[model samples]
Target chain A: MVEFGGWDMPVQYPAGILAEVKAVRKATGVFDVSHMGRLYLSGPKATDFLDWVLTGSASTLRVGRARYCMICNEKGGVIDDTIFYRLSEDRYLLIPNAGNRSAVVAWFQRWIDEKFSPGCTMEDVTVTTGLIAFQGPGTLETIDQVADTPLSGMRPFSWTESAIQGATVFVGRTGYTGEDGFELLVQGNDVVKVWTALTDSGSVPCGLGARDVLRLEAGLPLHGHEIDEKTTPIEAGLDRFVRFDKDYVGAAVLKDQQENGVQRRLVGFTLPGRSAPRAGYNLLHQGETIGAVTSGSYSPTLDTSIGMGYVLERYVESDTVLDLDLRGRIVQVNVTALPFYTRPRRT
Target chain B: MSPDDRRYTKEHEWVMIEDAAAKSAVAGITDFAQDQLGDIVFFELPKVGDSLTHLGKMGEVESVKAVSDLFSPIDGVVTEINEKLLDHPELVNQDPFGEGWLIKATMTDISQLDGLMSASDYDAFTAGPQ
Candidate 1:
């Protein structure tokens, strides 16, 4: 186990990262992601308060659906990327990264006090909840065996309350692994029962190491690596999540960036061989440093090296050739589109 | 268990002297090293005919979580590399002693082998004090 976000988290199970990754890609894999924060917001002004703070328009979110969104600071820099699930007309659940839980809760409280006052209530439900993610092409079949309510009709981004082993849980058809999966939020006491049920049903137990590779292969940006206090949504290529139709805290800055242009944009690249490029490695153009890698790894699925980095706007286009300086050894890389691997669409 | 036929280095590399007359030896990382590395994903190795000094940098082994430098246990000249690892790096994790052997080298100084630890010594070194 490794210390991550103040929690002792497993980096990989006994099966190892490679096997766990293969399990997720081919069959089913389960992860204990209980460290992630779950915040509950309820009140008449809940939607209004969320709209003011989150980049995505909360008022438009349909009940039982979740929307990917980010909370940005006043300077237009991303504070944290989150997913908001509209539990009901007046209630919502916001899931934030584990490390940013305290800061996000404080940010929410400040906003609530300033705008909604006593009209809205914000509760940190992280301690009381345990989160698990089941991901892979075989996720539905594996989960259906244990779910009290058949999960066949649930669409992507939709959630519903269900029971597993008689334990109440919130099941959402959302995941970060770029695979068909479900995220289950259950009472902390019931986590063991739920985990045992999933594992007994042949779901391979995975850990953070497989999770990182899976997300990187999918070209998903991790918070500290790709998006941070110094990065705006426009620069991170998350402009789609920033809805300009509604005003938000960092709306003006994002709109200005949209109208003008970003100085640097996130781009994906592939190394010619197995030499993996790691974070902080420099991207070189002809012998001059152009940018630094944010995240990289040897992609087990692609059987090659892949990486993501923020390059100057001029170098963000596809087919651009650059050299990745991996610990002083320069390896040629081709600028590719985001998502080095995409799952075959389920027909 | 470390094999009785090979000598170990402090850096976790092992050398098996194949021919004393020719001063030829085969080298690979020890099982302890592979266990610590998790799943081996990539390997950067010196090509055949490259010269290596005792305790010199030979190459690197990258796992999913980290990359560790591979050190030459003795002064030598690379005669052959395990080409199989180029396509299937997991051999290091699966068979660190046999099929995963990294390189065969013509030892430039056979006397250097005297300084290496025996299998029992290596086992003790890895096991630490009781």
Candidate 2:
């Protein structure tokens, strides 16, 4: 276990990260994500406050659906990437990174006090609740064996409440694993029960180590690595999450960046070997440094070294050959598309 | 249990004399080292003919979670690195005591092994008493 965001969390189980990652990819895996922030927002003007505070259009988000977006400062730098679920016409539940939980709350509260106070209310439900991710291809079948409500009809990015082990469970059909999965939230006391039921049904209990490797292989963005308070989402190739039609905290700058290309573009690369590139490794092209790796690791499933980093727009094309300075040894790298691995789709 | 046929170091490495006349010795990380590193992914081993100082930084042991320095328990000139680790570093985790041997080197001074701990001493040292 390691100290993460003031929480002592497991980096990996005794089965190890490689086994855990393979299990999540081929079968089913569960992650205890209770350290993430779970904030409940409500009131008549909650949507308005959220729309102004978020880059996505809250007005268009239908009830029971969740939207992945980033909370950015006025300068277009991302404060935190988050997923918010609209539970009702005027209520929403937002999940933020654990390390940035307090910052997100303070930022949202600042906006509420300035514009929508008395009309908007935010409640931190993180401590009182537990969140775990049930992910992979076999998740649906595995969950059906234990969960009372079938998630077959639940659309991707939608949420529904179900009963499991005589406890109220909030299930969201959204995950960061680049695979079909659900995020299970329950009362703090019932977390162990719900987790046990899932694991008892063949779900592998995973830890943060596997989670990082899985996300990197999927080409997903991570806070402080791909996106940060100083790096705008535009530079990170996250334009799709930004609704240009709506105005928000960083609307002008993000829109301006959309029309005019940003300075850097984040891309994925792969080397065919066990020798992995690590964060802070220099990206070299023609003997000149152009960018630096943000996160990198050996993909156990893909049998290759994978990494993500930002480079000049000129080198962002797919299949563009580049050199990755692997600890002073310059090695060739093929600029692959984001997500070095994609799960096989099943009907 | 760590094999008592070899000498153990405080850095969690084991050295076994292979040829006394040739001054050849084989070294690898201990079971404790591999366990602490979790899953082995890549090993940056020194090439043949490279000199390794006693308890000095030799290369690196990259695991699934983090990168840690690989320390040499014996001072010597590298004779060979386990070629298998170049392709399958997991061998370190699978058989840390046998096929996972990292380096084969000609020892600078055989007396260096005397100051090192034995298998039982290492077990007790790692057990606590830090």
TM-score of chain B of each: 0.96, 0.96
Best by DockQ: 2
- DockQ score, prediction 2: 0.83
TM-score for each candidate, following the candidate numbering: 0.96, 0.97
Chain A only TM-scores, each candidate in turn: 0.99, 0.98
Model 1 lDDT tens row, A31-141: 999999999999999999999999998899999899998999887898899988999999999999999898888988999998888778998889888999999999888
Clashing pairs in 2: none
Residues B1-130 of candidate 1 have per-residue lDDT tens digits of 8999989999999999999999999999999999878999889899999999888999999998988899999898999999999899899899999999999999988888889999999999999952
- Tens-place lDDT digits, model 2, residues A94-153: 999999999999999999999998999999999999999999988988777677878756
Regions of candidate 1 where Cα sits further than 4 Å from its true position:
none
Q: Against the unseen true structure, what C-alpha lDDT does each candidate score? A: 0.92, 0.92
Candidate 2: chain B TM-score equals 0.96
| Best by the TM-score measure | 2
Error of 2 at A220 (Å): 0.6
